[model samples]
Target: MERYKDIDSDSGVLGYEINNDNITVWFHGSARPYTYSYASAGSIHVEEMKKLAHLGNGLNAYINNNVKFKYVRS
Candidate 1:
């Protein structure tokens, strides 16, 4: 996602998700519950994009190179 100038970096991670029929986005702090649906996912890394496409649903997850996210809509 494009950086939000007003977003507080230490407050959370800002992310987006794009599916065939919808695009969603949200953010969460390190110790807070994940929030979703405010924007769209684009220009993400190829492998991450592929992983997200395969999952095919929405999810609240951490972004980790080793820990894969689940339920992402293709």
Candidate 2:
């Protein structure tokens, strides 16, 4: 997984791994990674997540505002 930039230091996200159709996010104080896939969170969310992950900002907010609890697994 790639470490999250958290440019503003206000994100709960600590790291993330992007895949063809999914994203695995690791949050602060979490021992497991949450998986949000195209099949679960939908292609739109997954795609947006990939971009946010790369940008190192807004991913946590995006998840909270849009895809909360949409992960397939942890």
Candidate 3:
């Protein structure tokens, strides 16, 4: 997992791991990670998430606005 930039210091996301078909996100104060996969979050959302994860910014807000509960597991 790579640390999330949270460039503006306004995100709950702490870290993230991106895979070809999924993204695992770790949030502040959370003991477990949220895994959003193509099957659960949809290919389009997951793909966009991959880009956001790599950029290290806006992943949290994007998840909140788009796929918050679309995670396959936690």
Candidate 4:
């Protein structure tokens, strides 16, 4: 996996990895990662997540508000 970019967030989302079908997130103080996908979060949400991930803002909030508990812990 690629290194996660540092971002400003209050959701404990330390960083993330984007891929063709999934977004894997690394949380602060957590050893395991979580993966969200189109099947879980929908394509629109996934796209928004990609943008937020690139922007280093809003990704954590978006996940909490929209897709919380919708990801697979890995």
TM-score leader: 2
> lDDT of all the models against the reference?
0.36, 0.93, 0.90, 0.79
**Candidate 4, residues 1-74: lDDT per residue as tens digits?**
54445454355677788999889888888878888899887888888888888877787788889998988644
lDDT of 1 at 64: 40
lDDT of 3 by residue, 1-74 (tens): 89988888888999998888988999999989999999999999999988887787888889999999999963
Give a tens-digit lDDT track for model 1, residues 3-73. 32323234233455454433344455533322222122233433353344345322223334422332233
Q: Using Cα atoms with residue i matched to residue i, what is each candidate's TM-score against the true structure?
A: 0.22, 0.94, 0.91, 0.80
Sort by lDDT, best first.
Answer: 2, 3, 4, 1
**Local lDDT at 1 for model 2:** 83
Runs in model 1 with CA error above 4 Å? 1-13, 30-74
Which candidate would rank higher by lDDT, 1 or 3?
3
Query: Which stretch of 10 consecutive residues in model 2 shows the poorest summed lDDT?
Result: 65-74
Number of the candidate with higher TM-score, 3 or 4: 3
Clash count for each candidate, listed in order shown:
7, 0, 0, 0
lDDT for model 3 comes to 0.90
lDDT computed for candidate 1: 0.36
User: Model 4's lDDT to the true fold?
Assistant: 0.79
Report the C-alpha lDDT of model 2 over 1-74, residue by residue, as the tens digit: 89999988999999999889999999999878899999999999999999998998899999999999989963
> What shift in Å separates residue 19 of candidate 1 from its native position after superposition?
0.9
Write the number of the candidate with greater TM-score, choosing between 1 and 3.
Answer: 3
